[model samples]
Structures are given as structure tokens and as C-alpha cells.
Target: MRALAAAALAGVLVAALPATAALAADPKPDIAVTSAADKANYAEGETFTITVTVKNKSSVDAKRVHYTGGDSEGVDDVVYGELSTGFDLAAGATKTVQLTGKTNHVAWQRGYGYVAFELAADNGEANDADNITSVRLMVAGAFDDLGGYVFQGESYDAGWTPQTPGVEGVKVVATSADGKTKYAEATTDARGLFRLAQLPAGEVLLTFTAPAGWKILAGENGEYDHTPALVIADDSDEPQIYVPAKKVPVSSPSASPSASPSASSVAPSASPSAGPGLPVTGDNTMLFAVAGAVAVAAGIALALVARRRRVHLQA
Candidate 1:
């Protein structure tokens, strides 16, 4: 009887175990950051728009899914600051939330910057791996602006250091470090200064199609033409790029000096013939000399004949 009673209790406990487990395993929302992106082309001293996509991986809907943004301080692993933004995410669905953040000066020591995003739900998350994400950040000084002049000639050895005179009306393009994505464009003003604000810091490439007859000065790398340049934009780094321009046709001066003078001299070909007074050229002077000689000889011959006739009559 005792063994049967114990077995019955054990069966009851086994049945109750599932109920306890079910109670413990509550229905929770699993939210995670699937992707994090910089919504705007960020620059130093400019505000950045960070977009975080949160996915509800659980079967239950995630209510009041909130997002926060942070950045690692220059060469440091610590992240600070939380942007205030939130949204509701349906089960098996994704919601994107945007927040604005001001970036600090770029960390040149690390050679790059970074931004982090965290996604959470009202209840709780089942997995943490997907809830946090980070990406490469590009920034300049938190309050600084980037601009410079484009002129003709080779860029001085350390030209990008200061704000030099700019070339007006030049179209400049700023692209992603990979050179595939275009961020923004600006036309230099009358002062030759063109500014794209809130630009991110990283290996950014610039594309400038110099004027038809102009060429951008070669950079420190010794290559002219704004094709691909890895520019580091930070407070410690040089925010301005001074480009010295050289004329496109390098041989122009040499080619022009002799051509104009030579052409003008040849154009006066008919001027000598059309002159108001006759020009005494070598050919014209020879003709005049021959005629004078013939006249003098005729006079001498006539005088000789007169002398010979007088002598004959006397004889």
C-alpha cells in the first residue's frame, strides 16, 4: 500500500512539474537590433541621425520597443549618452527608430570612430546577441567646419593645414570611404569655400572635376585631379585642404610665344605691295641699276660717233 501511494504522489509531482515550468517560462518579447545605420551624412560638429532597426524574434509582440545611441570616445572603448526614442514592434516584424546625436571630434589615434545601438522591449528579450549593434563612424570636430580653396598649381607639401583662398564655382563631391556611396556635393562660393556640414570621419574620398582648362594641384601623393583621396577629418587633423592648381595645358606658354609673332610677320606679305610708297627690295633695285647702265652706255656711244665723224671730215 505504501509503495502504491508513493508512486501515485510521484506521478502527481511529475504532472505538476510541467505546470511549474510553464509558469516560469513566461511569454516574453524578444527584441534585437537587426541593423544600425547612420541616417544622415554626418560631419564633425554636426548632428547625426541614427536609425536602428529592431526585430521581434519571439512569437509574442514586443510593446514599447525602445532604442538608444552611443559612441566610443576617442580611442577609448567606453560608450556614453543615450538618445531618447522608442516604438512598438509586432511579432515577427521589424521597426525602425531614428535618433539624432552630435558626434565628437574624430579619434586619429585609432584611425576611425564608431556608434552603437541598443534595442529593448517592455517585457524582456530572449536573446542579447542581436539586441546590440555597432558600425564605423566618421566625424570631425564637434563644432568645426571643413572647407578650403582650390587654386591653380601643385598643392604645397603641407597645404591642407590651413584655410587657403578657395576657387569659386567648382563642383566638389564627397563620397563614402569605399567610393561607392555619395554623401553630398557643394559648389565653392566666391571665396572658393564650399562646406558640407556634419560630415562623418573616416577614409572619405573626394571627386572634383576641375574646370575645362584647369587642374587641381597634386596632393602630397603627387597626383592631380580630384579622383580618390583618403581624407581624415578630425579636430586634431587638418579640416581644410589647400589645393594649388596648375594650368591643364602645361605647354601653353611655350607654344604661344613664337606662334603669334611669326604669324603677324607673315600676314604683312601683301602689305609691302600695297604700300603708298614703293619699297626698294633686292629685285627692284637690280632692275633700276640695269636701266641706268643702259642709258649711260647709249650716251657714250653717241658721243664717240660724233667725234669719229669730225676726224674723217678733217682728213
Candidate 2:
């Protein structure tokens, strides 16, 4: 009877040991989506790859594993790809599956969006049988194109020095002709190159700000000052700004011989007399004396002519 009890005990212990071992084994699915062949961002009509990795966590080998692309959470009506064939993933083993897809959607707003993925067993499409791992894909648009312009003079030249080299800053502001609407703005780097972007095609007022210890010199017209104005058209080329050197005071040249003497310096001297001993007559008296002399000479000539004529007639 004791022997029978021992055999029965041995059988019960063996059954309990198998049950304990099964309970200790891991139960979670080992499948994972490793990485997307293409990074988050994609251009239109670009082909990209999505890789799904499957690992069997259970003691029993998974005969077949399958995956499917699902709706992107935040993206509206975004499509992924046709699900691939089911492949065998052995126990405690991993396999990477590749899926090809194209981006048909475009014009995403200027923010973050994600692409999602769903995985499952080949036999069932329900959530209970499906081991789902989502790979988050970000979608973004391209950066805006900044138009080009030039810089010159002390701020840009090699010989020029700034009072506070590193601390000083310069920027270009573009606005409408009325200066009411701001279109674009760019800050100058140490090299003094500022690129303006996202500007509409029109007459843009390009203004510059001088760094510390520097000033912006305005040209004859306010538009083209130390910094020239840029008229950007749809087809216009990049603007070239020629900032002239600071105006240094130039000394005036000496007066020429032809130039009249300054009125402030010397008084006018009296003219010399026509006769050596007589003082020079005033302009009015000189005119009257000349007229009297001319009259007396004319009368004497007339008398002499008449006397000669009478003598001839008497003879």
C-alpha cells in the first residue's frame, strides 16, 4: 500500500512540475517594427520603404506572421501600402519585413504629423490575434526660399573694424512702398550677408541697421541710402547693394588768380590824375570839361572856313 502511495505521489509531482514550468514561460508577443526605410519626411511621388521586424516571444514557434498598414492617427485619409505575405518566424527568432509605399498626399500644413502602422497574425484580423506596433513617421514641408542681396563698405570690407565686433548686429527689413506692410527680414552674419525669404514679388523697401558705433547714411532719395533699394519682381535677379564709404571732410582748393579778391579784405584806391600836377577830377566834372573843349574847337574851324570862301568870291 505504501509503494502504491509513493507511485501516485511521483505521478502527481511530475504533473505539477510541467504545470509550473508552463506558468513560468514568457507570454508576450516578440514582434516589433524595427525602422522605416525612409525617414519621416517625404516629397511627392517619392518611393520609401517601411521595415517590420518580428520576434517570437512564446515557447511555441509562430507558424506565420503577417502585417498591415493602417490609418495614420492625426493625418486625414492618409494611405500606407498593400500588406505583405505571411512568413514564418521561429521561436525566439526575429525577421525583418520590407514594405514599399509612395507618398500621394502633399501640402501638409507647417507642423508635425505622423504615419502609423499595424501588425497581426495571418490567421486573424481582430485585435486579440493581432500584435500591433506603430512606427511614428513625421511629415514636413520644405523650407522657404530666401532671395539674394549684396553688402559692401566698412561693415563688409576686410579692413573695416567694428567697435564691438561680436556684439554688434545688422539686419535687413523689407516692407511695402508705404512702409506699412512688412514682407521679410534677414539678419546679417559676421560676413555681412543677409538672405531674405518668403517675400512676395513687389517693390520692397530694403532697409539696413548699422551696428554699434556705425550709422546708416541716407542717399539723395530715402529709398537708396547707405543701403540701396531693391525692386524685386517675379523674374528679377538677386539685388546688389553698394554701400558707399563714409564721407570724409575734404579741404577746399586755394583760390585761383582769376578769382576776385574778397570784399572784406582791402579798400579801393583813388585813380591817378590825367595831368601830372592836377588832382583827378570826379567822373561827372571830367565829362563836362571834355564837352566844352569840343564845342570851342568846332566854332573856330567854322569861322576860318567862311573867311577863305569870302576872299575867293571878292577876287
Candidate 3:
């Protein structure tokens, strides 16, 4: 009976050992700022991303873990209230949460601020009240008061005409280096000038297009080579772009031998002609010859009349 009782006690102890150890472990939720310290700096009123990583350090599973910013005493109000969703975490598992915040004041004066965080396990285990983790964020720059960055390039050749004129429009599009989104856009003026002001500092692509006519020589990629890329710096000035003009062949007038001769070639041949088949009436020599013949005929007729009168008198 004693041996049986000892065996029973040992079994009970083995089962309870894991439970006791888990309960004895400190219940403070593990929280850390996942964003790199160098990259987390922000300017006042500038929206930036903050990533917080939370882990269940205790052996007990945590259901529907709820978290909130602890205190804002030394922190900027602009850096708070940005978490999107709340989730549960399994024991020993980790969850990452993203929050967005804007700085209300310049962090340069204060150097850096703290963002305290509190966590509670949904499994009815209370967190260690004294062990909450607070992250420090520095403000490196001021919020940009300017609008989007403006980009301007040399105007295209005047001889270059668009394929579609009045109805079609020309636009300049600026895209992020990652190609995930378009940061800004501007329409070209009558002279094909575009401006994209106050863009974020990074590598970017600038692309322009109109209906037809105008062809882009550079800054294009892919099968048709229709896209152009450009880089923008943090302190960059207005960007200038120069696109080469596409040469269009002009059509010349067609010469046909079958067509009528030109006026200059036909004018000389149309003047009055004195050659072979033309009548002789306009010549001075012909007029003199005809007058002589008429005089001879008149003389012969006078002689005949005189002879006939003499014969009649004799009779």
C-alpha cells in the first residue's frame, strides 16, 4: 500500500511540474520596436511607419492580445494612435504590428521621444505592471512645407507635331523607385513643359506621353521602350529633362512624263509662224507682183478699144 501511494504521488508531481513552472514565469509581454533606429526618424507633421513586434514570453497561450500606447508624457501626440488592428498570439510566438504617426512638433529640440506600450493576455493572465516596454524615436528632419517636387525638361523641337492634336493631352508621371505607386503627376503646357514639385527623396522614374505624333527617344523601357526613369534627391532642385525629337520624312511632288508640258515650254511654239504651209498674203514681195499684173491687163484692154473704133469710122 505504501509503494502504491508513493507511485501515485510521483505521477501527480510530474503532471503539476509543467503547470507550476509556467505560472511562476513572469507575465510581462515582450514588446520591441521593429523598425530600424536610423530609419524611424521623422519630421513634424510628417507621416511615417512604426513597426512594433510583440512576443508571448510566458508558457501560457495568449488569446486576443490587446495592446495600447502607455503614456505620452515625454512623447509627441503626433506619434500616437496609429495601430490598425489587434490580434492574438500563441505561446512563444511573435506578432508584428504597424502604426503610422505624424510629428506635431520638431523633435530636434527634444532630441528623441518615447512611445510606451502596454500588453495584456486574453487568457486572463495579467501582464507584469512594472515591465512595460517603451520605444524611443528620433526626429531627424522637419516636415516638408513645400508641395510635390517639380520636374522640368528642355522643350521638344518646334517642328515636331503630335499625332493627335487638340483632343489628346500630354502628362508627366513620377513613380517611386520600388514601382509600387505613383508619387505625383503633372500635365504639360502648350510648350510641353512639366513640373512635379516637392517629391520625396529617392530614385524615381519620369514618363511622358501624348496621343500620337511625338515619339520618346530616351527614358523608355520594356518592349516598346515607352517608359523613362529619373532620380530625385532630398535637396534636389527643379529637374530638367530633354527628349530628342523624332524625324518625320516629308513627301516631295511626283513627276509624271504622261502629264501635259509646263507653260514655259509650250509658249514659244504657239506664236504665229511664216513656214511652208502658211499663206503668202502678208509678204511685201507678193503684194508688188499682183499690182504689176493688173496694170498689164488694163493696157491691153485700151488697145483693143482703139482698134475697134478705127474700123467703125472707115466703114
Candidate 4:
């Protein structure tokens, strides 16, 4: 009887061991902000993107990760604005999020030496030491614009011309003088115009991305090259220029000659500037020729009349 009771107690303890271990297990999640970088800086009201990466280092997964980015003098405090990633991160997984933030002031003040970016998880994290990062950037620059109409280099009827405002939504990119490091971009508007504001004072190239069935004409730089580099004086708007898009002539089948072709010669083509086959006016040669012929005929008629009168009188 004693041996049976001891065996029963041992079985009960073995079953409870797993339950006790599980209850004591800590499901803690550790999330840390690994790195943050400022891709570029922009003026107040200008938009820019920041890259933030976070890792879930704990044994449990993290959910609803949130990120807040701001600028401050110390770069440690999140003073500007915060945003949520609104996603789940698996344990041992790292995620890179691009957070876009705008400046509250027009220009970046010199007092703010650093930018702060932080990441957090909805599930409480065990360690919060690594959740923030900071970096410095140059946010000083002026705004300028280059815009113009894009049109077909062709003339139409009625001596009237039109612009290719049809090219709305076309992309125009502004880049450094070396044609690298894109500064900004804007889509052509209904007026076929695009502007790149907050530009640094220096020579920069403007490149137009051709839409379907369109191309820019050759220039001093090169055919279809990023347009000639332009100098933007401090806070000065670059002068607008006209851009021509190549037009492909449409082809149509020529009608067969009439069943019975006429013997008459085909008329001459119109003058270069004139619309149709209209004769040019005031031909001095023609006028003189006709006048001489009329004078000769009159002389002959007068001689005949005088001779007849003389013959009648003599007879």
C-alpha cells in the first residue's frame, strides 16, 4: 500500500512540472531602433523622407510598431511629430520604415543641431534604451522654378498655333549641375508647366522626361540631354522657355486617279507662304507687253482708215 501511494504522488508531480514551467516563462519583447538617417533636408512646408529601422530582439513578436520623428537642439527629444507603422513584427525580425515629415518653419534654424527619430511597439518592451536615433542635415537653401509650354514644332491651318498642354502629368526632374543627385521633381500641370522650388543658388540641370510619342529637340549640350545647366540667382525665378515636342507626320493611303484621267495639265503648287494657287499681283512685264500690243494695233487701224478716205476722194 505504501509503494502504490508513492507511485501515485510521483505521477502527479510529473504532470504539474510542465504547467509550472510555462506559468513562470517570461514572454517579454525587446524592441530597439537600430538606425535612422536623413536622406535630405527641406525647408519648412517642404516634405522629406527619413529612413528608420527597428528590430524585435526579444523572444516574443512585437505588434503595432509606432515611429515618431522630430528635430531639436539636442537631437534626443522627439519634438516635431510622431507616426505609427501600424504593422506586426515577428520575433528577431527587423523592419525599415520611411517616415515623411515636414518642417514647421520656412527655414531650418541654426540652433537645431540634430534630428531625433524614435520607434516603439504596442506591446511593452523590456528594454527601451535603443529606441531613438539622431542625425544632422543641411536644410538651408532658396527656392526657384523653371517652367514652360511644350508644343509640337509644326504649323497648322489659319496661321494659328497651339501648345502641348496635353502632356499633363509628365515628370520634370531638377538635378545638380553634374546631372546627378536629384533635388526635386514636379509633374507638369494642365498648362504644361512644372516648378522646382527651394533650390540652392548655383548652376543646375533641368531634365524633362518625355511622354509617349514626344521628344525634346537637340541643343548645344546634346540631343535629348538634360537641358543646358541654368544659373539661378539668389531667390530669382529662372526665365520660362518654350520646349518643342517632335511631331510625326501622319500617313494616309493616296486615292487612285479617276477612271478617266483628264488631258489638261495639273496646276502649279501654291507659293511657299501662300495657302493656295493664287497668282501674285502687279506683274510689270505683263502690263508692258499688253500695252505695246494695244499701241501697235491702234496705229495700224488709223493708217487703214486714212488710206480708205484718201482712195474714196481720189476716185
Specify the highest-TM-score model's number.
1
* Residue 123 local lDDT, model 3: 56
**Over the stretch 1-315, how does candidate 3's per-residue lDDT look in tens digits?**
999999999999999999999878746443322332335565545555566676777666666666644653223433433232446677688776665554544343333455566655545544465325665665543212112211222223322234322212456676755667887877665555556765553345666564454444444322231344433233334434544434334455698569787775443333456454434353576567789999999999999999999999999
- Alpha-carbon runs more than 4 Å astray in model 3: 1-40, 73-85, 126-131, 141-315
TM-score of each: 0.36, 0.31, 0.31, 0.32
Question: Over 4 Å off in model 1, which ranges?
Answer: 1-12, 20-28, 34-41, 67-71, 74-88, 107-112, 140-315
Q: Highest lDDT: which candidate? A: 1
lDDT, model 1: 0.61
Q: Residues 130-216, candidate 2, lDDT per residue (tens digit)?
A: 365555443444333234323334433323333323222566687755778877787766655566776543235667675544444
State residue 107's C-alpha deviation in candidate 4, in Å.
4.9
Candidate 4 versus the native: TM-score?
0.32
Model 3 TM-score (2 dp): 0.31
lDDT of 4 by residue, 18-37 (tens): 99999668576788775444
For each candidate, C-alpha RMSD in Å? Answer: 14.6, 22.8, 18.1, 18.5
- For candidate 4, list the clashing residue pairs, or say none: 142-199, 143-198
Model 4, 83: alpha-carbon shift in Å? Answer: 4.7
Task: State in Å the error of residue 298, model 4.
Answer: 99
CA lDDT of every candidate: 0.61, 0.52, 0.52, 0.60
